[model samples]
Target: MSTPATSRARGVERIIDIFRQLHAARRPMTMRELIVATGAPRSSIYELVAIFSEAGWLETSGDGSVFFGREMHYFGADYAAHNDLISRAHQSILSLVRKHDETAQLCTLEGNKYTVMLSESSSRPFNISSDIGVKVPIPWTATGRLLLGHLNVNEIRALIPDEDFVLENGTRIAFDDFLRDVQYADAQGYCCTEGLSHTFRLCMAAPIRDRSGVAVAALCFMTSRDTDPKKRELMLDDLIKSAKALSEPYSRL
Candidate 1:
C-alpha cells in the first residue's frame, strides 16, 4: 500500500500532466472538460488550477475556463528569437516566399514536436495560408516526416511517444507505414502530400540541414492539386533550391 506522502506526490504529477494537456490544446479549456479529459477528481484539479492561476501560468476566463497565460507567449517568443537556427534563417525564408508566390515556413525541433517559428505567404491568394507559432506533431505531416528522416529508425521511435502520431482530424498511419513513407521521401529528394490539410490543397516539402547535415527545419510550398503538374514541379524545384540556399546560412552559423 502507498503511504500518504506517496499519494501526494502522485497527485502533483497528475496536476502537472493536466497542465501540459491544457498547453497542448492551444486554446481555452473549460474546467469541466479539463477534469473529464484528465480523469482527475474535480476538487483536486480545481485546487491546482487555482494555484496555477495565481502564479500566472494559467489564466481563467470570466466563465471560469482556463488557458495558457501571457507568460507562455513571452517565453515562447523570447526562446524563438534567441534560438540560433531560426534567427539565422529568416532572410532565406523571406526569399523563398517571394520566389514561390506561396507559403514558406520555418519549423524547429521543440521536444518531440516541431514548432512553426517563422512563416510568410506571397501576396497572391493562391493557396497561401499557414500558421505561425503553432506546434505540430512530427508525423503524418510532409515537413514533419522529412525532419524525422534525419534520425535513424530507433532514434525516431524513441523520441516520439507511441500515441503522439494520432491527430484529431488527420489519418493515423501505422508507425511502420509512416516510416516507409519517410524513407521514400528521403530517396525522392522531397515530400509531397495530397489532401492532408484540405481536399484540394497539396504540399511539397524538403528538409533544411545544419552544419553537420542534421535537419533543423523544413522549407515547404503549398498549392492546390488542381493546379497544373508542370506548375507543381516548378514549385517543387524552386523549394528544393531554396532549401539548399537556406541550409548554407544555418550550416555556417
Candidate 2:
C-alpha cells in the first residue's frame, strides 16, 4: 500500500533514473530506449517526458531523440559557480596544466567509485585525460588511495566491491597491498602510481583536506610513464602545495 507521498517519491526516483541513464549513455535516447533503460512503464515514461520537456528539463531532437535541455546546462553551471571546492579546483588545475604541461584533475569519491570532478588537459602531443563525471573503480587510480585515507582497513574492504581489485590488464591487486598503499598515502600526504589504469600512464595525487584534516578531494596529474623522475618529483611537490592551499578557507579567494 503506497501512500501518495511514497508514490510521488518513487516518481522522483524514476525521473532521476532517466537522467542518469541519459548521462551515462552520453547521447540522446529515443522513447523506446528510455523505457528499456529506466524500466518504467511506457505510458508513465511518456507522460513524464512530456512534462519535463514542457518544463525545459528535457528536449526532443528532430529525430525524436530525447536529451537534456538548456535548462539542465543552466542548472549545472549554477552548481559549479556556487560550489567552492569545484570553483577553486577548476582554476587550480588550469594553473597546474600551464606550469607542468600535464593533464591535471580534481577527483573525489562517488559512492564506492572515484570520479573526476574537473579536468584540464595538457597541450603536449601525447597526453592523457579522463572524462569528467565518469566513475571508475577506486583501485584504478592513485587519487583513490588518498581519498580513502580516512577509512579504516575494514571500512575500505566493505566499501570496495571485490571485483574492483582486478586491474584492466587482468592482474588482481591483493587487498593487503591496496591497504598498504592507502596507509602510505595517509602518512605521506600524497601518492603516485604507474600503469594501474593505463599501461603507459603515471598518476600523482595529493589530498585536499578539510578543516578536520580528512581528505575531501584529491588534486592529481597524469603524465606518461616515461616522464623524467625529477619532473615527476617537482609535479608531486607542486600538487602537495596546491592541495594544501585549496584546503584552507582563505584560499578560496
Candidate 3:
C-alpha cells in the first residue's frame, strides 16, 4: 500500500540517482546514455536533465551532451580546500620532494579505495609516473597498506571483497599474507613494499593523521631498491619528519 506522495518521492529519488551517475562518469553524457544508464524513460531523462541544467547543476555541450557544471566544480573545490586532508599537508609534501629528490605522493582513503590526491615528481631523470587522480586497491600498494592501518583486519577484509590482491603485472598477494603485512605496518609506523608493480621498484609510506587523530592519508615515496644506503636513510628521515610536519596543519582544518 503506497500513497501517491510516496510514489512521487520514489520518482524524485530515481532522478537523483541519474544525476549521481552523470556526476561520477566525469564526462559529457548523452540523453540516450542517461536513459540507458538510469533505466528511466527518455522523457523522464530529458525532464530531469533539463531541471538540473536550469539550476546550473549540469551543463550541456553544443553537441547536446551533458556533464556536471561549473557550479559543481566550484562547490567541490570549496569543500576540498576546507575538507581535503591532503591540501593542508602541502608544505610537508613539498619538503619531502625537495629533500629526497624522489617523487612523493599523498594518498587518502575514500571508503574502500585509495586515491592519490597530490604528488610531486622527482627532478631526477627517472621517477615513477604521476599518480595523481589515480585509484589503487588498498592492499596492492605501499600507501594502501598505510591507509589500511586506520582499520582493523576484519574491517579491511570486509572493505575488499576479493580473496587475493593482484598487481597490474600479474603479481599477487594472498589475503592472509596481505593482512599480516598490514598488521606489520601498523607495528612498524610505516609500510614498505617491493616489486608490487615493477620488478625492482621499492616504496615506503607513513600515515598522516587529521586533527581527530584519525589516519586519513599516507605520504609515500617510490624509488629503486638499488638506491644508495646513505641516501635511502636520509630520505626515510625526511619522510618521517615531513609526516610529523604535515600532521600539524591537519589540526587547523
Candidate 4:
C-alpha cells in the first residue's frame, strides 16, 4: 500500500524522468516518441503532459510534439543567477575565450564521471566542441585527471570502473598510467593531454580548489593538436592565470 505523500513523490519523479528524456534528446518529441523513450504507462504520460502543459512547464508544437516551456527557461535562469561557482566561472571562461579564442570549460566530477557544467565555444573555423552536460568517463578528459587530484590513489581506483579505461576510439589506458597521471596532476596543480578524447584536439586544465584545498572542479581549454608550440605555451600561461582568477571565489563558497 502507498500513502498519498508517496504517490505524489512518485509523480514528481515521473515528471523529472520526462524532463531528462527531453534534455537528452535535445528536440521536440511527439506523444508516441515520449511513450517509447520513457517506457511509462500511456495514461500516466498523457496526464503528466497535460498537467505540465497547463502549468506552462511544457509546450506542444503545431505538430503536437512536446518541448520545455518558457517556465523551464525562467527556472534555469534563476538557478544560473544564484549558483555561486557558475556565476563566477562564467565570466572567467568568457574571458579565456576572448583571450585565446579557444573553447573553455568549467568541469566538475559527478561521482566518477566528469561534467562540463559550463562551456564557451570558440569562434575559430576548427574549434572543438565542449562536452557540456554530457557525463564522460574520467580517463577521457584532462580535466578529469586534474579533478581527481583531490582523491587519493585508493579512492580513485575504487571509484573508476575498469571498463571506463576504454576510450571512444578503442584505445585502452593502463591503470598504472592513469594513476601516475593523477599523482602528477596533484603535484603540479595542472595537467595537459593531446589526442585523448578526439585525435585532433589538445586539452589543458588547472585546478579550482575549495577552501580546504580540495579540487572541486577544473578550469580547462581545448586547442587544435596542430597549434604552434610557442602560441600554445602563451595560451597556457594565460589559462593558468585565468584559472587562478576563477578560483578566487572559493573563499566565499
Q: Which candidate is the best by TM-score?
A: 2
- TM-scores of the candidates in the order shown: 0.72, 0.94, 0.76, 0.92
In angstroms, give how far residue 178 of model 4 lies from its true place: 0.9
Off by more than 4 A, model 4: 251-253
Q: What local lDDT does model 2 show for residue 18?
A: 92
Ten contiguous residues minimizing lDDT sum, candidate 4:
244-253
Candidate 1 lDDT over residue span 1-253, tens digit each: 9999998998889777786777667678998989988988899889888987887878999988899877877887787677666665677677776765777777666788766667777787555555665666777468777877767889988988777667546566588988888888877778998776556768788878877776767877767777788878888887888788777754222
Instruction: Report, for all candidates in order, the number of backbone clashes.
Output: 0, 0, 0, 0
- Ordered list by TM-score, greatest first: 2, 4, 3, 1
| lDDT tens digits, residue span 1-253, model 3 | 9999997897798778776677567578888888888887888778878887998888999999988877877886776677646565666777788877888887776667777777888898888743555556777678777667667767887898583377777767888888888878877878878877667888888877667666667788888888888888888777777776677654333
**Overall lDDT per candidate, in order of appearance:** 0.76, 0.92, 0.75, 0.86
Error of 3 at 67 (Å): 2.3
On lDDT, who's better, 1 or 2?
A: 2
- Pairs with backbone N, CA or C atoms under 3 Å apart (clashes), candidate 2: none
Of the candidates numbered 3 and 4, which has the greater lDDT value?
Answer: 4
Which candidate number has the best lDDT? Answer: 2
- In Å, residue 238's CA in model 1 sits off its true spot by 3.8
| lDDT score for residue 192 of model 3 | 78
